[model samples]
Target: MKSYKGRGVVLHTLKYGDSSLVAYLLTDVGGRRSYMVQGVRSRSGRGSKLALFQPMFPVEFEGLESSKQQMHRFREVRAAFPLQGLPFDVRKSTMALFMAEVLYRLVRESEPNEPLFDFVWGCVGALDAMQEGVANFHLWFLAHLSRFLGFCPGNDYVPGAWFDIREGLYTPVQPAHTGVMSRECSAILRDLMACDVRLLSDIGLNRSQRVEFLNAMLVYFGYHLDAISAVQSVRILREVF
Candidate 1:
């Protein structure tokens, strides 16, 4: 067995039989890997501690030689970042679930992507530190995700030009009944692209505008990516925050 250690986030977790769990982890060094965690149902199990059910945890694992592509066995797992605030807040929890679902769907397993991994690690930290307006997390997350997925909004389009979601370019004519934001929406998006998660709460869109913008962004994602569903957390976020 070859052992490795690094920082990681729990992207998804599922029970295997009664006492064991299969966890999808996004590691800083290894990109994404699955680990078979034992005794997770027990209170004192290390699996319980190293799981992604909690945010911002450190992990150590050993890969088995029998199946090079199978889930690794975890040796040590612990929370590297103490989360005092994000878990307690409803908005933040909902937002976390949404992002987790998105990552679970999008991030590939066993690929080395340091930049995307670091972005997710930093995002979990920021979500923990957020004090107000947690709804803004989705905006920042989506914008950054676009950058990573190579569908980032373009800059060459004139202010009045329409955004072509399919082509990922700016156009003079909008498609019929397709996803298109207004000129004001484009300007706000440009502003959002320049800001980080912390700077988003004060970005100045009202509740409805935020919801509309979020819907448009999701549509933009669906236009580019396959099988991407409308995020469930969007409604909960609008209802609470």
Candidate 2:
């Protein structure tokens, strides 16, 4: 096996045996990779390492890789920074879960994507610092993430036009297929297309509006990426906000 060092965010983890676990990560060097970590669930001293695997936590790891193995080994893991709010805040935690799940399904590259990694890392920093407007954060995050995924739904708001989910663009008329968004929600998306994430707290939304736009963004995502059938964390997120 070859050794490499990189920074990554934990996306998902599943129990492997009684005390071991398998984790999926989006890393700066390896993109999306899985690692087998033993003793993460134990009452022994090794269990303390579990904190390094929280969703959306920025961490640096040294990895042992080989072509013959489907999962690699990561060691010497350390948190890049302490997240102030994401781990403690209920709404932000739910948002992190939903965003992580979306990324887990969408980010499939085994090669490096420097810009994409930077985007996720920066957004996580902003999410940890923000104290308000948590509801709109995920909406903006997905809107910007779509850009990196190559299906950026551009903001082309016509007076009576629809945002075509399948086309990943705007249209003057309703799309023939079921992949479309109304002008109102499309307007919100248009605003999000250029809004700075640091100002996510400034974006205002009622509960229903949040529900509608989030669903619209998911539909837009579903049209481009078939793997994302549903985002389960959204249910708890809706309740928190």
For each candidate, the alpha-carbon lDDT, in order, equals 0.71, 0.85
Q: Model 2 clash tally?
A: 0
Q: With candidate 2 superimposed using the best TM-score fit, by how many Å does residue 182's alpha carbon deviate from the native? A: 0.9
Tell me the tens digit of each residue's lDDT in model 2 across 1-241: 8999999999999989887889899999979999998777777665467887888889988988889988998767789898889999877888899889889988899999999999999989999999776779988998889889998866556666788887777888788888789888888888888688777767788888888888888778887787777657867766776
In model 2, pairs of residues that clash are none
Residue-by-residue lDDT tens digits, candidate 1, 14-106: 878877788777887677777787777776664354344442333444443235546677666656667767668777777777787677777
lDDT for model 1 comes to: 0.71
Q: Give, for candidate 1, the lowest lDDT window spanning 10 residues.
A: 57-66
Task: Kindly give the number of clashing pairs for every candidate.
Answer: 0, 0
List the candidate 2 regions with Cα displacement exceeding 4 Å.
45-47, 158-160, 175-177
Measured by TM-score, how close is model 2 to the native structure? 0.92
